[model samples]
Target chain A: MRFYAVAVYGFLYLPIAIIALFSFSAGRSASSMDGFSTGWYVRALSNPFVMEALWTSLKVAFFSAVLATVSGTMAALALTGMKGRLRAIFDVLVMIAVMIPGVVIGIAALIALATAFSAINPWLEVVLGRQLSMGLGTLIGLHGMFTMSLVVLLVRGRLETFDRAQIEASNDLGASPLGTFLQVTLPQIAPAILAGFLLAFTFSFDDFIMAFFVAGSETTLPIYIFSSIRRGVTPEINAIGTMVMVASLTLLIIAQILLRTGTLRAKG
Target chain B: MAITQARARALLLTPAGLWYAALLLFPLAVVLIFSFGERNPIGGYAPGFTLEQYANLPARFAAFRNTLTLAPLGTVAALLIAYPLAYYLAIKVSVRWKTTLLILVIVPFWTSILIRSYAWIYLLGGNGIPALLEAFGLGELRLINTPFAVLVGIVYGYLPLMVFPIYVALEKLDKSLLEAASDLGAPPWRSFLQITLPMSMPGVMTGSMLVFILLTGEFLIPAILGGGKVFFVGNALVDLFLQSRNWAFGSAVAVALIVIMLIVVALYTRAVRRFGVRRDDVGLM
Candidate 1:
């Protein structure tokens, strides 16, 4: 069992380790590590295309995370007051949102947006003399809505363990509902919401399929990587990959620490 | 005040409710409606109603076939490898290092699957594994751009998704049940077969469903690793919409894929219910 576990861990991490190690290669070939150098990292950073895509990805991730966190938290909070059939329907919708494949979401969103654009672009042209097209806005909207389900799940999970007595106590003391929520509920769910936001951001930053479909003329980092890699793997691509790996892993670690400490504090 | 509270609840739900209605429900409804429409001469959809796209579903049957076969295979392969690792982590690992070990399991997952699949391309390409094998007198062999390579990428990409659910299930499992079973003179293996496996079925189901559903719409793995040979429904959808601009047919494929996913979820739900697992226990997120 121990050997099997070790092997599985190796399987999971070896490719990632290889990517990280080879990213600093002085050689141009991705398959071989000629010597240690940060040239690829420098080159990747200086490349205008990579930087532009990275900036777009960051913008999309930031906006989507904020949107998802706020809206999903609100939905989760409201769902607490719901029950019976209405709650059940909402639960199904959220679950379906999460369960639907990224590809399907992409295609569905593409068609939906296309249909919407055709119907709305004419009106916009008559008024603003311009048209709405898919780009950063679409990417942010798609990622935010999709990831909102995740936020809802996380906050709802936290709410399950939440002590309702605190809210009642605040109410009994003549505290306003808003005051009680601000003082009690927000603190309790803050960790989950933050964790959800980090996850949402990570997902948006790393996403390719849905972005590929609806990004229109815009490019995301993952989409950039996909296209560049299709040309052929390079140390530069490896450098970008390593950077993404490091960035997301760091975020994940922070989120993990937050969740663990949050639970510990709650228990204490 | 009561009316205000009701209004506040409505206000809270409005954004998410509208978001879902617009992005989620409306999009899906559009796909359904468009699937029945006809493709124009120029490629995109036209307003005419027709069953032509549905009838033409067999045009991309190979893509559907490959996805159905490989997605299940990938799920089962991931499950086989993941179950033991999850078992070791939950059952064998000491508490002192459990969190670190668990986090290590997820570290790779935090990275983009696209980047991870890129790494696999080099590893399975001529100079990586094949080179090593040649040094050992195994001779030359093709690995990249094959179905085998795609399977490897799928398993590698989805391992954490598979691992976590089973780990959560095992972690939540009552160890006392195993002790009681042993106290009744059941062998260790017997106790495991009776207690551990059944209890973790929900996790197994959840992980499998997640992987399977995602794999059905998988585009990146087969695209990056399969090198255009191993087509999936997702690839077909991408080609239809992005490349060919066949919106109607793409919508049909999308509709088909959703129906298949719905069926898988329904079956999984039934199985979970049969095992008497609470719906909440099978965490999708």
Candidate 2:
């Protein structure tokens, strides 16, 4: 069993380790492990398109995470406190949002946004003096909603063990609702919220399918990677892939740390 | 003041509610409606109610066939590999090593599947694994752009998804029960079959469902690893919507995918309930 676990772990990291190792390779492709060089890394870093796509992904991730975290936090708070069938409805909505395959969501988003923009674009041109269909804003909006379920789930996990007496104590001490939330409610659940934010950010940043549909002409990192791969594989792409792999892993580690500590300390 | 409490709760919930309705429900409704519509002259959806889109399902029968076979096959493949790893991690690992090992399991999951698939291209491509095999006298092999390559990628990609749930289920298994079985002269293998396997069914079911559903819509793996040769419904949807611009047909495909998923999930839920093991394991799915 122990040997099996080690092998499984090896299998898990095989591709990632290969990509990272080959990223610094002097070899043209992965087959030859020819002595190492930083050429591919340098090229991937300097490539203008890579930079732009990374920037676009970072922007989308940042805004979507922010939107999902805030909205999900509110929804989580409301859900933890509320009771009734409305909660069930919202619960199903979250499940449906998550359960719907990325392809389905992609097409659905395409239809919904396309019709909305077509219907509204003419009116916008008449009123606001310009026509804008799908763009970065729509992409961000769709991504934000797409990842909101993760945010809510994380927050609600923390809320499941949430101590109610703290809130009651805050209210009993004459703290305003806002003050209670900021000082009392927020501090403990802060870890979960931050975790949610980071996760949603990673999910949005890594998204390919949904973004491919609603992206319009704005290329995010994954889409850029997809096009580049379609053209042909190169060591530079491996370099980019390695960089992204490292970045997301770091975020995930930080999130896990937050989760573990949050559960332990928030037990108070 | 009474109304303010209700109003405050509503205020908190409204954003999420409205967001789901707008982004999730509304889009799905659009897909459902568009499924019955006609593809216009230029390719996008046209305004007409018709079963013609449904009639055209056979056009992508190849894709549907590939997806149906591969989704289940891949799920089984992932489960076969994942179950043993998860069993070891849950049953055998010491606490000192468990956290590190578990974290390692999840590390790859955090990275983009695209990046992982890209790496596989090199690993499975002519200049990679197959080349090594050929040099080693395994004979010339064409692993790249094949169903086998796609399956490899699927199992690699979904390993963690299947592993964790089973780990959770196995960890939750009461160890003393196994001891109880063993002390009664039952062999370890029999105990495992009688106690551990049955106890872990929920996790297995959950993991399989997760892998199966995701695989059904999988595009990136087959696209990246299959090298445009293999086709799944996801590839079909991508072509229908992105390449062909056939909104009505694409929506019909999407609806078909959903109905298939619904049937599978519905049957899975029934199985889980029948086993009386249904729990928050379903929630994770």
**Candidate number of the best lDDT:** 1
- Give a tens-digit lDDT track for model 1, residues A32-114: 88999999999999999999999999999999999999999998998885776768978999988898888888889988998
| Per-residue C-alpha lDDT of model 2 across residues B106-180, encoded as one tens digit per residue | 888888999988788888888888889999999999998999999999989988999999999999988988887
Candidate 2 clashing pairs?
none
**What lDDT does each candidate get?**
0.90, 0.88
lDDT of 1 by residue, B1-285 (tens): 878877887899899999999888999998999899988889888987899999999999999999999999999999999999999999999999898899889888888899888888878998889999999999899999999999999999998999999999899988887878888999999978878888888899999988898888799999999999988898898899889999999999888998998899889889888876543342321
Listed per prediction, chain B TM-scores read 0.94, 0.95
Interface root-mean-square deviation, candidate 2: 1.1
Candidate topping DockQ? 1
